[model samples]
Target: MREGKRLGRVIWAPVGAAVLSGLVIGAAARLLMRGIALAVGGLTGMSLAGTVGILVVFVVLALPAAVTATARPVIMHAGRWVTAALTGLMAARTGVSDAKIIVLADDGQLTPITVLIVAFAAIVVLHGRLAQYLTRRLRTLPESPAEVLPTPDARPV
Candidate 1:
């Protein structure tokens, strides 16, 4: 791959890691939600079917984490984009249903935009090392004066 692409990889590493973290958090949230659902379902006397439903929820909840681990960069980028859109969409409304209108009005303090900015910042910060890894520098070979290859221009016509 070209150095340029590798450069992006280096830049995106931290973002990818953060994305993975986000996926983990999301999975945790889903797990909790499913657990709650199962408990409620059981209390309602929903039976083994209710517990089976929770198991299904667990499977669904685990998918994002698995996907993010495999493709964290893409996930991070998508999340950044989606969060930005959601923030913008939320910003345009007046007398919103939310009790926290200021959160939407603000650029990112409470918005998903915060995640985007952070991921972008992370990518820019660590891009160099990533680029180096992707496009590793040519190794220097020890040589005597005679070991050097003659330049084309230095050769006799």
Candidate 2:
């Protein structure tokens, strides 16, 4: 029982981090989307603004995922999973009637949960690929020495 408790605590670190990161990132994404929408709408027109804003948000959000994927793929994967879960929870909390919106007539509509799932999947794939490419590129580059060898006179006592 004690061992099980210890294992549970160890497992919870990544799980907690994933959930916290997801919640924070989701809120940031929403705010970014909203701000972009308002700015674009005011500058251009409503219809185009909505489309452009969403595109911008997706692109912008993907960048961090790509970076995190490179630095820590596990964290990125966990974050994506948590994001999807949170989206579902939020949708349920809001009630079914208000959870979905029509994006296109013939193409079909999507709920917030669906959008988040799609976005998270896209981010994971894109970031994973980008990270791989970057790693390859880095490997091909010549290594630089960390520092000049310490001179005999300069050596510490």
Candidate 3:
């Protein structure tokens, strides 16, 4: 029973992280889509924004699954690729969103792909360690404490 419970805890950690990350990343992607829609200024822009935002959400959700599955040494190298992909997507999404603001400031147009490329380069070059931080943190969390109960003598009759 204890082992089963332990297995459940192990399973719950990754599942819970994935759900929470989904909600958070989903909101951020929505905001980015809104920014893209505003920047592109048409129905076509809304379509593109929706596509990119959905892709981002899907990519972010995949991170937790990747981390959970790659926890063992059998395919350890795959973990690095997963981390890199997640980080790159995060940076690209952020860059596109930031570019929207920059375009507004300059009163000019900018392509999302251009900003995505620049952000990917910048993040890989400057913040290489940011990848997997959240997933790693979740993976290392301590298990819950054991339960305690009162003895029969201590219980009310």
TM-score of 2: 0.29
Model 1 per-residue lDDT at 43: 29
Per-model RMSD to reference: 15.6, 12.4, 7.5
Sorted by lDDT (best first), the order is 3, 2, 1
Instruction: Show pairs that collide, candidate 3.
Output: none
lDDT of candidate 1 over 1-157, digit per residue (tens): 5576555644454344344433433344334333433433322234566445533433333333222332356664443444334323332331133335324344433344344334443433232223222222211222235558776788897
- Ranked by lDDT, the better of candidates 1 and 2 is 2
Candidate 3, which segments miss by more than 4 Å at Cα? 43-60, 63-66, 69-77, 83-107, 111-136, 139-157
Best by lDDT: 3
Q: Model 3: per-residue lDDT, tens digit, 25-79?
A: 4545555545554655633244566656654654454454435443665443455
Better of 1 and 3 by lDDT: 3
Name the TM-score of candidate 3: 0.48
Ranking by TM-score: 3, 2, 1
Off by over 4 Å in 1: 1-6, 42-157
Worst 10 residues of 3 by lDDT: 123-132
Q: What is the lDDT of candidate 3?
A: 0.51
